[model samples]
Target: MTYKPATQDQLLAIRANAGIAELAQSERYAAAEPDLVEAIVEGVGQFAAGEWAPLNRIGDLEGAKLENGVVRLPDGFEAAYQAYVEQGWNAIAGSAEHGGQGLPFTLACNVLENLGTANMALNLLPMLSVGAIEALEAHGTDAQKETYLPDLVSGAWSGTMNLTEPQAGSDVGALRTTAHLIEEGEHAGKYRIKGQKIYITWGEHDLAANIIHLVLARLPDAPEGSRGISLFLVPKYHLKDDGTPGARNDVRCVSLEHKLGINASPTCVMSYGDNDECIGELVGAENRGLAAMFTMMNNARINVGSQGVQIAERATQAAVAYALDRVQSARAGAEDRSPVAISEHPDVRRMLLRMRSLTEAMRGLLYYTAGQVDRGDIGEPQAKARAEVLVPMLKAWATDTGIEVASLGIQVHGGMGFVEETGAAQHWRDSRIAPIYEGTNGIQAADLVTRKLGLEDGEALQNLFADIARAAADEPQLMALAGECAAIAKWMREEASLDDRLAGSVPYTAMCAVAVSAWCLMQQYDALDDSNDADRKHAKRVTMRYFLDHIVPEAIGLKASATAGAALLYELDSSVLAA
Candidate 1:
């Protein structure tokens, strides 16, 4: 991309937000040792530049294919996954007892961004595996952990989440899959699963030795609807007592889906119990499968948000690179023969700067969310709650921003972005599913509205406003922006119910994200004020000024409209739809 450094003011602002600097100053990145920080960041940069960079286009082109009931990834996938395992990248946030490095999730967030920025599709397997590891660690039986986790954490095996069925997608209550108690009371504890599951990610892949399918089904004698559902661990191949693959299990891949994006990650239609004899072991308890699945679902949602960030970053880099090299129209006052890189144009610069601001700001927000996670590691009630409040916000905000940033990237490339070879078009298509999958963005908004908003009668949101206000207290310009955010927070509290409050929830959610991001950037500015890194601090100030001047006002308008209500968008006449 363009190599020009940020201006003096912009540079300073970034130093203020460095993870290490925050930790040293207070419960921040400094929570980890300096050498550890350096090592992790270096590893992330290397992985992104080395293995991931080259295979991006390769994976998208080759995608994932189904053969003999197995999903085959792109050409370089096995090698890349092996390399990731060798580097211990998959174990970054896993428990140390299970062959992991035991690093904080926040520490891993930057690495996640780099991986995604390098290639999102190829990284899907690892991401899903990590979530499965979390679920197993949190709720799996001791035997289950011993049998599954070492391979999963070591990246020797992969995992899949099975929640969707033909009749059931988001509504889990509609699930038809049945888990009948087998052999009466002899093998009564065990169940036989019978049903088809679709849209399962990393469902039946060849990238790893064995695929663990976490299937949710209902017991024969259990109550109807969601209350009767139970989680089962159904392996692709039955494991011998020695933990080796013995024979084929009853589960099989019926087909692979041809999708819009993330082509390298197989979205499968899986059939369970073709012979009506799939042995399935229970996880947690019967009728509590939804709760168990949630452990994986929540992590997946956050990872999906990171996916959005990754695509946006890639799109921005591509746009910036293209703009800097492509020569276009002459300047208004220049000689007739003179030409300039497209970036020199006013509109192009605006789009580029806007893309940069949103991307950086979103990254800043995500990292801050990570930092909160780190802070939660300190083991305090308030710290834990603070981290909880940010999770849903981060999940919703970053993914939505991903969609917006990627679309803007397409705009920057003009018509070329729509074509196949440019690589810009693929980002747009790939990012579309992030919001829809991993709990739709609408679900995220509802979560923020219903759960996060009402925390302690809105005290959590109130405290959030206080933090924003504190960050902007020194500058009059930013103070106005902070006040606007605070006013919106007030409106949120005044709104009657969850549904009513979320009437304009999309913009309101965006407003919260952008406001918090600006706060983080401002905090970075505060931290760097005393630093010797003059250039870094200067660039930061300019960037911050630009954000406050050009960007914060839009958030102001969003807050106003969110407070106003959503009749216009919702109340349109049915006759208008006929056209």
Candidate 2:
């Protein structure tokens, strides 16, 4: 089955509902007219479906290999990456000052959706690089930007965030990586970093000339825990005084982890300063590396959420195609009927709709959150806060939905889905990591109920509820669900204890996502004017109804689970479960 990009009607509907057009009209993106945006999206879709999708199976089958401390990608992987760079896709939303196109992030989101659906593992390279470019643009010294940003934006160089270690996974403070200032050498004033970092994606690859690593290590006299941690810009190869690639840095890919999915993406264990000669420059202030790294992590989180949307879209497309082509049982009520496509079966149709509706909802939430990010980039304070508040929900909910939808896609394929040949299993395997990527879903939910809820004395959250309420006001069907969400928000803020809130944070996040997605769909439904094509409008209307009737009810169960408190969670003894 061929991969399909979102329809013109769907894209237009998303843009209209999410205020992407208004963002385009802003002075920052003045050149992003509707036609140009549509054309760029279509071009990317064509490229992704034609070029990247074909290599997905091959990449999965062959995966990446560790040969003599160098990570070698699967066949055709390097060529695809070169074509990606040559096409200038990496710079679509990058800053123009650094050789980027300076387009809006919303446009980038569209391109990435297609690319990721076509090939997820390959898409991760640019995704991580974009996050690195963002961090450098935000905190890198002027010289650093001048030396690194151009190559990163041009895709000639790739980037990696190195924070995890053998013992420090989420507890970044427990990391043992150390950096000492170089006293006397050509690289004096820089720090010589030493440590082992694990789970480093694309840490070593032949796709790029250089790999710019944003590493977190402790400086001498640095305090303990997260506050004492600092960020460093460490390159795979040392840079010459002329700002070109120089001697090989004391960094090596010690090994690669055999993974269940995204095998094409090299997950490496990197040893820095193996010879005590790896030089790294400080990024922000001393003992503030975590803060600087957050810039990259936050950007990566959104892209991870977008990954969820992408994989779900891909799975749904495959499932629907399979359902329409595979013949099985006859129609239930028809006498003397011949066997028909499984899509004619009620259960299969139900599964297809589940995949379709959830994918659409996840996309709406992802793009809407991205629009908030774009507005925030343009210095809208409220928009910034809103984007911050929604980031956790966006990451957790969308990824969870991705896993569920991918599993459903496999279910739609019956026995074939269980086998590696069907390709349905790959999506499920690939999506599994998204919940754990950037930060685990558990961490995201905890952040939602704790830090994000406390922002602006809860004004950010209140504003979200108000927006949903206002959007639901015009449509009576959405009112009850909107009210339920409002009640949950209030309970979360005023009634639930902190521990209780944490207990239900996952479900609470889901409830919020459902409400937000419902609002997005309602906006699209209401925006369908008579001038629009009838069939397109009708399809939107039907999807909106299907979501309301079948999917929105999940919010109620989520709300109940969210308010259930932590008592039952810890009541049982640990030994009972073991027995």
Which candidate number maximizes TM-score? 2
- By summed lDDT, the worst window of 10 consecutive residues in model 2 runs over 9-18
Model 2 lDDT per residue over 290-398, tens place: 9899987776888899888899889999999999999987889979589999999999988888787777777778778888888988889998999898889889999
Question: lDDT tens string, model 1, 1-579?
Answer: 312212221222223333544544554233456566666766676777688877888788898988776677777888888888888888777777788776667656666677777888877878888777877887899999989998898888888888899888888888998898776763477889999999988788777888888899988788888888899988888888799877888999899889999898788899999998787888888799989888777557667777876887788888999888889889667677588898988888888887777766766676666656555665545655666666676778888778888888888888888887788888888888888887777777777766777677767777877778777776565566666655666666675444456776777777777777787767766777687988867866776666777777777777666666656555777888775
C-alpha lDDT (0 to 100) for residue 455 of candidate 1? 79
Candidate 1 regions with alpha-carbon error over 4 angstroms: 1-31, 183-188, 335-337, 475-495, 530-533, 566-579
* Poorest lDDT segment (10 consecutive residues) of candidate 1: 2-11
lDDT of each: 0.75, 0.86
Score candidate 2 by lDDT: 0.86
Mark the regions of model 2 whose C-alpha exceeds 4 Å error after superposition. 7-10, 474-477, 530-532
Clash count in backbone of candidate 1: 19
